[model samples]
Target: MTIRLRLAALCAAALVLTGCGAVITSPDQVTPEVYVEQPSVSPAAAKRFGDDKAEQAYQEVTKFALEQAFPEAFLDPAKKTYTAAELTAGVAPHLTPTAAQGWSSLVTLALAGDADAQDSLRILQFYNVDDPGSELPPDGDVLVRQQITDATVDVEEPSGDSPERLLVSFRHEAVLAYAEAGRPYELDVTKTMSYWLAPAGANAGSTWLIASYDGRMDVAVDS
Candidate 1:
């Protein structure tokens, strides 16, 4: 994997494998993986700015994270039902077999209309808007911005010594979304998200995806 950066996201590109956990089978009986291509590192990279494998892994991971971070598919005002294929598109790629095992198990429950998944979706409502068109896509959806305050890449030891994880991180302000009044809604002016990525396998060509994430957005505001 290689490390590359973009305007916030557009990270993970294409990879050979799919599914972070288990194969997701929707009630509609359409396998999400069919519409998705194999996971690969994202393109239009930062241009030889960082380690190849780590940057590539970061691209792969952040792209998926930004996609899933959106509250759109899950919190549309129409209460639109996200097809398993669409809902699972950005997440499935770039997952390691080990991560996929646990991921699939949890996502399977979510796809099955599980309460937990529903609850997870509910949390994203704060980012939701009845009208997405209120703001331009670029302004509302700056996945990778020039605002990264800090970044670091760590390549794990091979030979199964240190779990062979590729960790990349970015410390940046949280990008918020637009709401009904046509104004940007930033809940926390001081909040920032710390992103982390890990490789899906031990080999040099092993793909990457977000294995862990930690951030905070606790601001006193009226939503």
Candidate 2:
């Protein structure tokens, strides 16, 4: 569902769709919203990471969390979508209950054509059933050509949300393919996204799970 994030992990399954009787040849037309929340920064990355150990801890925890969740989270099939329970079950052990619940919301958005989905497998993308910015062919089946490259990661200070929180950001360079009025087009973009994680338990040694994620794609694929 996370066409974008899944794009990074190479784990999304929403490639070519058949059986609905429609051939999709176009990418969704996006509408820009004036107000999108910025990724929350509690103490600012540099200020908090002033301590090298804290910075290292965040990086280690992020890697550990991904190792635990990604293996299970990135298994969506092209014809099948993941349920909230399934998603939570895969990553909840590394995250808070609320974050676990919220993971489902991210999937819902991805299924609905939100570009903000988490990193996964697969390269092709399609529009969700709803979402104004998305345009799909009849029968809702589509095939996409997309490429995401140059992925980089950075660890920031803890989120301001509570005593224990950390934010990790992923950056990528992408070439998105789509169609408009039966013509082919490609968008060169830079996408920056992040995840906020919290300590699994009350202890410093506890594992971490993503609490929230914020994504922004800085290129327009509009009509």
Candidate 3:
């Protein structure tokens, strides 16, 4: 039988069971890839605002934001560590300065091993088998993949026959598998993310940049 691990209750459970009996180990010089399910515009959205160029831009921005926020994607697989500067610089092209600044504290906290912060960032991967009867623990490499679906873009502000600010939302699901280990385990996670985008300059045709972002972790059930 598979048990679902809820990150929301991790901290309190950490106190009771030695933090789920799983140690966060740094992997080798191999960056695990996240398989992203490409964003698809709903039929309703296409009918409402059929701007393919803007839709593609929104999708690119969303993908970038997701990758930067995901620890498995940003961490230096070679060194098994990451720097705030690297994170900031990587996101500079896609996110506004203010938005990048807002992510600083969260990134700092997650790197510092803050459980709550990691949960809030939707990057925590450690799992524990609460059942005492479970077999051995996983002891091999880590593999992670995330899928995006039901993506839709909404024109929040239409200024004088032009789309000004756009809101993009999508559902994110991830499966972190440790199949090669002793008693292999996997963590299935689901999250919803939203991004607010606007032109970087006053000109309506300027490059699009993410102005704000929000994410929420949904309850994950074992498959």
Q: Which candidate is the best by TM-score?
A: 3
What is the TM-score (0 to 1) of candidate 3? 0.55
Summed backbone clashes in each candidate are: 27, 15, 0
Q: lDDT of each structure?
A: 0.39, 0.39, 0.51
What digit string (tens of lDDT, one per residue) describes model 3 on residues 1-223? 4333344312332221111112122333243344343456655546655678557765576556445544444322233455667545555556566555545665576679776755544432222222343332253233355555666776665668434556777776665543322456565667666776766766433367766555665544242
Among the numbered candidates, top lDDT falls to 3
All candidates: TM-score:
0.47, 0.38, 0.55
lDDT of 1 at 110: 51
Task: Name the better of 2 and 3 by TM-score.
Answer: 3
Model 3 C-alpha RMSD vs. true structure (Å) is 11.0
- Poorest stretch of ten by lDDT in candidate 1: 10-19
**Which parts of model 2 have CA positions greater than 4 angstroms off?**
1-53, 57-78, 104-165, 173-190, 202-206, 217-223
